[model samples]
Target: MAEMIKEPIENYGLSSKDRKKTLFSKIGIVGCGKEGSKIATVAATAGIEVVFLEISDDRIQQAFDRIGSELDMRIATWGLTESEKKTILGRIKGTLTFAAFKNCDFVIEAVRYDDNGERSLNHRKEIFHELENILAEDAIIATNASSVVITELASELKYKERCVCLHFVMMQPQSRILEIVRGLYTSDSCYNKVCQFAKLIGYDFVTVEESAGLISNRLFFILLNEACAILQEGLTTPIEIDSIIKVGLGQRQGVFCMADQMGIEKIVPQMEDLYKEFGSLKYKPSPLLLRLNRAKRWGVSTRIGFYEYDEEGNRIINENEKK
Candidate 1:
């Protein structure tokens, strides 16, 4: 069945008071990949117009499809109605041109990692320049990276004070918490606006110092690396390790399972970045991760990583595994 479209509230029927002030009225997202799609959905769900840039027409359609599928999942779970999905979808627009970003109150640069899991700093800085040229001087520009790219990207901008970084938590649309990074050049007004934007989207923000891997990725890399080492040393199976983390540590998912969800492809490059920044062996990507990434096994995205998965992304158990 074709999805119905509804007129978004932001597009019409606003009172004179609402017309007087605009608070993040429009958000532009560069690179509508896995992470970008989620951010777009969140902002659009909050009734903000979301203009997302994709590389091509097909990629733009794919991003819309991904967002629709996620909404369908919520509909299936009774979290959203069909009408609400239509409203949210109506608020999102996909484009190939940065010209669509003009006049955007808030813009997020969320470039995806390449197939090899590497993202170039120079390329990201170029995107920063691109956004700065289009957005207003007071508009905020943020990157959706956990690494230390924010400060350097900000430094290249004419309005360096308006640049900040935000790291959305993995694995959910409604994650309540967001990690906010303030660059050295980021102004107090910019940081405060980002925090206000977070609250507008129903997320609480945490301030993190400028560092490679920021807060979540730094701690998560260590936990995932230790888990990988345990698997390498033959101390436990992937399933068992996950079980211990779930049952013993009371985590929602085991470290390995979450790693798979986040993609080994993305994780490995971040580990390399962190290692280069801090020169710590603990931040190094485990041998197992590199092997899997080299083999092109990108976890749930590819249906293979630490564990095999079927087409539906459900893990397939081995015959020898104990129930």
Candidate 2:
């Protein structure tokens, strides 16, 4: 005989309705550009709710299109189902006001660069203050900053302890590791929570002291500059150098190729920031980068950089390699 069910209906719904809420169930992103879009996609893929703020409706639509296209590529390469893509896209929303982030557990500032190819620190600081006023005291405020220090951004916040640095490397998204930096006022609780956030989104985390460039930029910049120096010395073509690095050293992408993807205009300013911070020649921008920046060949966004690209952002390979 079949056993009679004795459990109440509430018992079945207990885990569904009464379970403890997740720490980062909902997150807010200040900008939805390349960096912000990557973070939004990652969080949404992990079943987290995401709301990103854009300057206008057009930008919001552009972000959605960019995210949708990225998901399409994943569908082709990673066997992600179209249904899964819809689910991921469904979890994300875009807004035009900071008030929309009122309920977000974590808010990350990833604003895009201005026309001058630089992000304004004043604007970021203002964003932090705006978020603090709207967000709960317990909610965290973070920046996807590379060269800027977290302490400076957190200095003006009422809840400075909640502000931290969370840098994501856009180059190697498959092996992307998070570099987390704790500010002068970052509490132990805040830092630990960020570490949990990293794991929640399927990333490995490294605890870093407050510093400009953190781990990713400081190391990557030197490698890139040295590679540029070799090119300057008439050593070899970019293809040859990339071949040796990829085949011999097992690098994921050629140094110059990575720079192109990163945008020469942005790289020069960041290099200058590092150089100013460390007072070292190693942190200085390469002359080649300066030339590219001056000429407005700012990488895939412009379809040109150290190498040329087609409209689809695929680098065009010519039989005669031209710098």
Candidate 3:
């Protein structure tokens, strides 16, 4: 039997201080949506060449524009020098084809549910197959999926050993914690490389079993779902619950506020998916969530999730606006 490699965190060589840096210059990011763009920006900032692959020219332009704005924000808020910001922005190139990933040392799939609410696993699988056909054999394939099983996705690929999951927290630039999950067939070398790369990019790495939702989202959504359930049951009002959790638990922000910041539309569907997969009572989507989603109140993006936002994107709460 092959020696079982424990979680990467337990291995000495894979420790943050001991892991070797790779010559990973070029990285390809598929689905330049929210998390995708953030991943691309971080890699680019670290001087890694980035090719952002999306389905359309409009999306490619939108991603580039978003990255540009983010780079500008980092310069102002994080005290990044103008030259440093320029170099970071210069490392990113947007493309509409998977062919651009040919020379990439790593390809990360950031595509999630489509606009039509269809999960695009097959579409992403096709992209992975195409990348495998074109990219170097040594290249690593990664997914940013929050709920999908990395092992299941890896099973469809030719290089299953080289494929793993690199789950980042919601706010990529600010959030330091990253969940690094290894599939059953993931090679030790590939796992080690990814662990090293996580440290290289300055994330606090936590190794998790290849479970759906991993650690952070799994625990987080449970709490969020419970908070939603309480609100739906009329046991407590949003503000009341927020006040209790903040004051009693010493939390900086309330659950609903954090949910609003995370975007309700994004969280609701994932909650539903998790319920379907796990059949856990706690995973059930709250009625309040279902109602809000039906009403198209999708949080900050839609300007009306748990709380309403003004035309200028400032969150506004009016007692009269309560549903």
Best by TM-score: 2
- Residue 209 in candidate 2 has what lDDT? 87
Candidate 2 lDDT tens digits, 241-323: 88887888898888778888888888889999999998999999888778888999998899988888998789998977663
Per-model TM against the reference: 0.90, 0.93, 0.84
On TM-score, the stronger of 1 and 2 is: 2
Query: How many collisions between residues are there in candidate 2?
Result: 0
Q: Candidate 2 versus the native: TM-score?
A: 0.93
Which pairs of residues have clashing backbones in candidate 1? Answer: none
lDDT of 3: 0.79
**lDDT of each structure?**
0.88, 0.90, 0.79
Candidate 1 achieves a global lDDT of 0.88
Per-residue CA lDDT of model 1 for 233-287, tens digit only, reads 9997998999998899988888877888889998998899889899999999999
Task: Judge candidate 1 at residue 188 and give its lDDT.
Answer: 96
Alpha-carbon runs more than 4 Å astray in model 1: 1-19, 171-174, 318-323
